[model samples]
Target: MTMPTSLCPYRMQVHHIKQETPDVWTLSLFCHDAWPYEAGQHALVSIRNSADTLRAYTISSTPGVSPFITLTVRRINGGAGSQWLTREVKRGDYLWLSAPQGDFTCAAHPAGRYLLLAAGCGVTPIMSMRRWLAKYSPMTDVEVIYCTRSPQDVIFADEWRAFPVTLFAEEGAAQGFIPGRITREHLACIPHLKDRTVMACGPAPWMEFVEEQVKSLGVTRFWKEKFFTPSAAPATSGLKISTLQPVREFYAPVGATLLEAMESNKVAVNAACRAGVCGCCKTKVASGDYTVSSTATLTEQEIADGYVLACSCHPKSDLVLA
Candidate 1:
């Protein structure tokens, strides 16, 4: 596969950090040069201490509002990358980051009305879209549905409250908030549900639930960004991969994702949104058998062209990659 040489990594300094929730923090990064990015896109970030551990995070700040880029991250208990950013990283520290990438943006497909659904830290990208609409498309009709464990867990609560928002909480319902998980009945009541474009972002199970509910409502235009990967069955065999760019070969462990395998063997493959929602890890299979997960961000034509998302694919047999 031919990689874009212009998408090289750049360095940014951490200007500030703000703790939003107990487990979530937002980092403001100052770039030496102008950072061009659209709302709802993500950046691939790598810490200086953990050179090989790269992670993708959505850009939370609007394009024209600030000189710096912001990323809101939720620290998972044992996640090395998240833990490092929330606990160890400090202001003045520098990190390597790739240019913004991903197709989960409203600019790609404009709609008359929009329904934005988000849960937990998944609100980051949606927040970007919201800010953009508030600034550039002020007259657009938009509604937001946000879910969290409790009132305290809501990220950007103040900003979100400025718009038309419906909150769902698992505990302690507050004013303008509902209790429990979003149900089909809840979605069924939305006026003109079928006419509005739905954009959802959240954990895998939450996204799946929302997708089914929206489809049941006869909504035709739906776009989603899932932050977590769905559970996959165990792999029965190992795989051998040949990579291009910096030509190299490696052995992938059974059940390991192609991207994970490549990373384990020290083969650098530019990847963002490791959950497979982004096409950054796309590669052409020169000669190989592979089973790509259903969550892969690939079109039918791309699949026919022998392209696969390394983050969501497992090798079915020894493979040779372009």
Candidate 2:
């Protein structure tokens, strides 16, 4: 069997489906052969409906714990990818998945103690780390704060009972869950917060707020796996975006993401997360001036080499991309 690469997707059959909540499901997909990935990585899952639509979903199953990959999907009302995966996909159905990608794992960024902050479905990656730590480094101090809309909406409710994890809900009367949202007080309440490395995931805005609160509490090491924040519609500044290897050009607006314009113009490129988090869309800018929302998974050398996340990058001047 061949191993999957970042750009080459592999087919995996849905082996099992367990409903975690009314709107959320845990899907176990057969790897056939072991899939190589770290706990905090995500895969680009492609589903076929009217046409093929792909979306990034964090792999919730820890590699050392399960031979198969599991994706916990929350059914979004109008989200095509989530809706299809949660409602349409069935056992035995095969889904195309990109290789596990991202660097938001303890293996990549280790700490003596850790603070995990997850909101809603963002719990996927964060909890996967907890599972990984339990298997590989049980003595490591780990604190968890998971926020949900309500207690009933919490995914992985059964498994959490065995661990020391705090659950917060905006509403819903639950015996153990804290009422209302995660506040600065809750973050400050973590003992020796200064020494823990914080890993958080959720909507981009929510992450920013959590990061702010985390920093305010004297914590310096903060890691986040990002969710895409869609840019506002562009007003057509007519900037030229040129790509090589067949060498094509397209016109885009100032605020338009490079990935969006490329796809619209039929210029092929590998991309996932459409957010800066995945780094799947990182490309070398032979010549260009642009602004990127975040350099989440990139290294200093890659940045110096002019590598930019096409998903978050907005061209400022006429651009030539490799």
Backbone clash count for every predicted candidate, in the order shown: 1, 0
Residue 113 lDDT, candidate 2, scale 0-100: 97
Residue 283, model 2: lDDT of 82
The TM-score obtained by model 2 is 0.76
- Measured on C-alpha atoms, candidate 2 has an lDDT of 0.82
Cα TM-score per model = 0.76, 0.76
Q: Candidate 1: which stretches are off by over 4 Å?
A: 1-8, 49-51, 229-272, 275-309, 314-322
lDDT by residue for model 2 over 1-322, one digit each (tens)? 2323444367788998999988889999986655799998888876562223467889999987876789998887666678788888999988878778788899998988999999988999987999999999999999999999998998899889877999898998488989998899888989989999999998766898999998988999999987553332333458998788778777876556788777556566666567676666778899978988888888999999999888888888999987
Q: Each prediction's Cα lDDT score?
A: 0.80, 0.82
